[model samples]
Target: MRLSFPKLAHLDIRRGLMMVLWLQVAIAAVMIAGDWLGRNPPGAPSSVPGMSDPVAPGDQRRRFDPDRPVPRRDAPALPPGIDLPSTYPDRLTFERKTIEGFGDVLLLNGSIATGDADRLSSYLDGASTEDLPATVALSSPGGQVIEALAIGRMLREAGKNTAILPGMACMSACPYILASGEQRRVSPEGYVGMHQHYYDENLYMPAYFAVEEIQRGQGRTMEYLIDMGVDPGVMIYSLTTPPEDIYILLPEELLDSRLATEMLD
Candidate 1:
């Protein structure tokens, strides 16, 4: 007859098919495990990359959050200008009086204005020389030196008793006037001081020139006071000391220095 082809066994074929299926299943399992490991690794928390945790209501961060805007504070406005009064509280006043038997005790108020040289000269000329009265006054803030000196000379020439009322302050040129008095009186509150003679430079001249003039004027003033019988030492001390540091003499102190002939209560 004819040679027939040998047929393969069914069991061998089935075993080969089973081996192929097992290989495919193993490869699928390996791929699934790798994907799981990359997505969720061990020891790492599962959260969005940049997201922060929720904060408590009482936390400081919650109070002043960067995302929130803050309210601004308003400030008060300033006044446009200051309202200062023209007149000051303290003002000097001069009062005059007459003593019948004593001729006339002219209380040269520190506030009196004898005006310019011509006017002052006329006033002095008109004054009666026979019954020229003494001047009794208290002075603190000094005024025109020329006027003060003129009054001083007049008092000295008339031989009238010039008195500085104590508790009263005689300062600057005022002391020169006091020196003119034949008698100086100091009250409990009497004080005397001197300052460098001051003049307006802008109204006069350069500083050096003004200073020279002041010095000359001061020298003349000192000479007049000294010649009129004021102690040279006292005048020197006054000239040297600043106005603020001028001599302060009580009634007793003045009497001790011979600056005052009498002390009034």
Candidate 2:
């Protein structure tokens, strides 16, 4: 008979499996250590250093540094007397007063100084066509021709019935304003007159500088009066006549001169 080897009884299947698992764990730990060593070698800058870095207090950018403390921003102070201008009264002024009972009767008194255009326009801001039953109580020595014309045109367009009140006088460009009214009336003492318009020739310097701006002004006045529906002869006579002769024409004289539609009783 052939010699047969007896079956080996020294192998333990469970113990062999445990030994294999231990070997795999050891290999994984070694691989992880090697990878860590490769990535961060010796002599590299430490994330957690042994010595702390100092920051200077005067440095502007120190607050922005991640490792440093942040600084607070200071706010600016406001200026003094915020409402000072409102407290002070205006040095140059124009007065536009409304008279009671006269209903829309606006009194314009003072030397029609500069900036009257804006002031007058503002005064009449709320006025409407129907409110034209209102009258303008004018007592101006005179003012800018352009501004006066603007006021006259505005009144005419509003269809305001204008009458130079009994005691008030309309002089210079003011007369043109009266002519613009649908019905022009005057008080017993209310004088309506015009003289040559004058400008400070010195203000214009070289251009339009003339001693005879009066004549030029007269021509402009005549043109404006005609456009405002005043008789051409009335305008011509008013402009050419001396200052003393510019009184209201008598009813007979007005009719004879074809200036009046009907004489005032």
Candidate 3:
């Protein structure tokens, strides 16, 4: 018969296992804390890990709405040859950015909110007195009625041409911007929509003044259409459509209504 060592107690074995488990849990918690601290080092400016700059409120372009603001989602898939610019300017208003490969062309993709005209003016001021962009590629869902008019007028005066490339949209007050273009073109895969301007729910203007202001804005737009060689009657589509809904004109309708000088095939 061989002598046997004393057997370990079950309670003692369980306690040892529990101690190991607790040690592992503590180690895991320390590791997690270390990773978090490394990512967000003390005294560093708060920022998204991957973003170059801090996100700004109302930074994204959106569909124009009298009652609410809806951010624009990424555009739908487009034809292979269409090139959308990737560069975004640092400003918060409607701005111009050079297309990466196309030096002469510029992208204006944003809402035409208040003070946007001033922003545009500053962009134009960067150019020589006689020289300006050859083309202004547009992708917008529109914004403040008066601001859009101001920006459009500036575009027209400068004789800048405009286009909505594939997978892009130009709607609401955007059509006014398009009209201001000396030569307006719409891609078959692009969209151009229109709707009436209603009283902005966020504003506190009197109802009578709101109505009068809208009428005045409409009249100015009609005159602008005439000046741009587009038919003033196109206002009919805008006047009848509710502000909340858009009337996307068909390719043929765009031509017939004179909203587009030509459709890119």
Candidate 4:
């Protein structure tokens, strides 16, 4: 039987209200999904400094065109009171020194060239037989990037502290090694300068190779910072500085980057 006009009108109103409620639910669902995606977008790096959240296994990496012009870095000022090394060191040497109050400390001076990490390892092994150093002091003009990185890993694994002691300098890859310290200290008279990674000596290296090397080193450094719980933002200064000059971090900048947990008086 056909419904009365009044009953039909009532039925229509109910159906309309139900439809509106369903539409509202659908909109809310979409919004929730959008927010989730924004936080864990495909191929996006972690926004939080010193943390790595790898992309899900199935996520595709975003690739950029190779022909794009790469950005250039400006020359940075030499660190105050530091003179660039006239030449790479003949060799890296590890010295055992005793500080007046700090007890035994290992001193790493000169260039961090190839085989330097092996030398450091041998030193540590021999020293451990007697007594390990309370801290490893760095004073170098910097050298091989990979050697410095290896040295840093060894320091971290050995659970030793690192420092730029008074009347000393630590520049270039030295800062990377310094980051491995369980505790890092910088004396007022100490220096820690930073610069972009130097992968090759050839000035006319291919752009593609240079970019590739830089990206590789950048990834390693970022990972190292995260592992050490240090803020990777410190790299901003390094990346901006050309390989020739140095970017000396002010006291506040050093503290901000967590590079110096304490500054000795």
Candidate 5:
């Protein structure tokens, strides 16, 4: 006589099925909890232990709140201050501030707006009236790539060093300014990020033309990096990071990219 497996003791079969059902339920609960936490994550480090390299969505990330205005698609994951200027701030303004450890700095704050490049050039032209700051400190969410590039060239011409202290951010095209620095100093606590650049598309313009323009812009940027002594490889982060999220560079990446000559010890 042969014993069929399905005909085994009813009690034994029932117990095994119950155990599997409960295990599945427990797994579902854990996954649900993980997703909920991810919605409001405290942000993970750029380079986790045992990881080969630093990547996107790191310590600087925050939940995307619906209340915030999404400027360019390539804006930071964590929006800037509440009630702050989303578009161009009236204009990029400069203030003479004295920062600790770094001494006096010419603080450039607010969004980079149209004609801001001319404004910066004018500011430096009159810098002789007052004591010139050793460093040009940047704090902005970034705007107007063309303006940012122009400002960067002016900074490079001036031979000013750059620094970013904690409690402030330098992201997007702002890094171009940082790269222009004769010497770059950064505090790990300060946030520095990058993402793909966005250009306003004209309905009248053909797709191929738009693509060509973007390529030319990128080429100029790569050339600028080379001239600034920064590794063009750093653009890898900018290219890979999505427009919706910012890629916060780790201290190591900053050093490796030559974006920072030295960091807060």
Candidate 6:
């Protein structure tokens, strides 16, 4: 006679499996919530991760809200002489504006969003030769970095020059567009800044994959900068700066890094 082992009850085995599945579901739900909160802080724009400064930030800084400041996400008032548009544009707006120094510039004002690049491209493609802008006048707090890169490349291919007027602030990804100019110009009081960028990632993606995505984005940005004739080494400022606060480049820094091909008096 052979000894036989007792079989576990099917109901008990099924219950154990159910418990494990429920536990996993609970864990995944918690992780997704946490990631959402981290990326979309209560006071910040849920879709935007902007670069700005409030009283020369150190470790903590307010997220840029070009439309208006939130109760908790406050940034410093614009410096003297700087002016926000009469009606702040929610999305990037490109309009022909005749300025004192830069003539017939496509005043690239308003907040840049994810789809702005395509809008710009479409507008340029449809414009007549007489209406095509030779200069892109930047006056933005900046928005999505990827879109900025795309816009910059388009500007480069079109052989457009970029400039920042005295009262305009070109913080965050706006500088990438500035770098694309064959003859970049920044006024003495123009605000051109940079900071770290945020890349979109799926909630359920592994940490390794997220890191890889970020690296790829950064690599593409660096490569784009080099292609635009700006030194990629200038990204050092971007890499070191916090995403919330912009690193205001010194006038000399702009000249030295070749980010500004020329200074506007």
Please tell me which predicted candidate would have the highest TM-score against the true structure: 6
Go through the candidates in order and give each one's C-alpha lDDT: 0.49, 0.47, 0.65, 0.68, 0.69, 0.74
- Whole-model alpha-carbon lDDT for candidate 6: 0.74
Residue 186: error of model 3 in Å? 0.7
Compute each candidate's TM-score over C-alphas. 0.51, 0.49, 0.62, 0.64, 0.66, 0.75
Estimate, for each residue in 16-117, the C-alpha lDDT of model 4 and write its tens digit: 899899999988677666645643367756332110112222221211111110111222332343343444355677777777656667777687788988
Q: Candidate 2, residues 1-265: lDDT per residue as tens digits? A: 8776455345478877888899988886776666455433678453321112222222211111111111122211111211112111221132334443334454555445556667766756755645434555555545566667667777777665555544344555566666666655554334344544445423322222354675666566667667767676766545554332223334343334333333222
Put the candidates in TM-score order, highest first.
Answer: 6, 5, 4, 3, 1, 2
Residues 99-198 of candidate 5 have per-residue lDDT tens digits of: 6446777888776777989988888887784667878887776667778888888888888899877645677777888888999998775667777765
The total number of steric clashes, by the backbone 3 Å criterion, in model 2 comes to 0
Candidate 2 lowest-lDDT run of ten: 61-70
What TM-score, to 2 decimals, does candidate 2 have?
0.49
Candidate 2 residue-wise lDDT at 123: 56
Indicate which candidate wins on lDDT: 6
Question: By TM-score, is 4 or 5 better?
Answer: 5
Q: Count the clashes in each prediction.
A: 3, 0, 0, 0, 0, 0
Q: List per-candidate RMSD values in Å.
A: 40.2, 37.4, 19.8, 18.7, 16.5, 6.1
What TM-score does model 4 achieve against the real structure?
A: 0.64
- For model 2, the stretches where C-alpha displacement exceeds 4 angstroms are 1-104, 126-133, 199-208, 211-216, 241-265
State the displacement of the C-alpha of residue 251, model 4, in Å, after optimal TM-score superposition.
1.4
With candidate 1 superimposed using the best TM-score fit, by how many Å does residue 245's alpha carbon deviate from the native?
5.9
Question: What tens-digit string does per-residue lDDT give for candidate 1 at 13-131?
Answer: 77878888998887767665654554336875433211122222221011111111111112111112212122211223333444332334555534323452344345557766643
- Residue pairs clashing in model 1 are 139-169, 166-186, 166-187
* Model 5: worst 10 consecutive residues (lDDT sum): 63-72
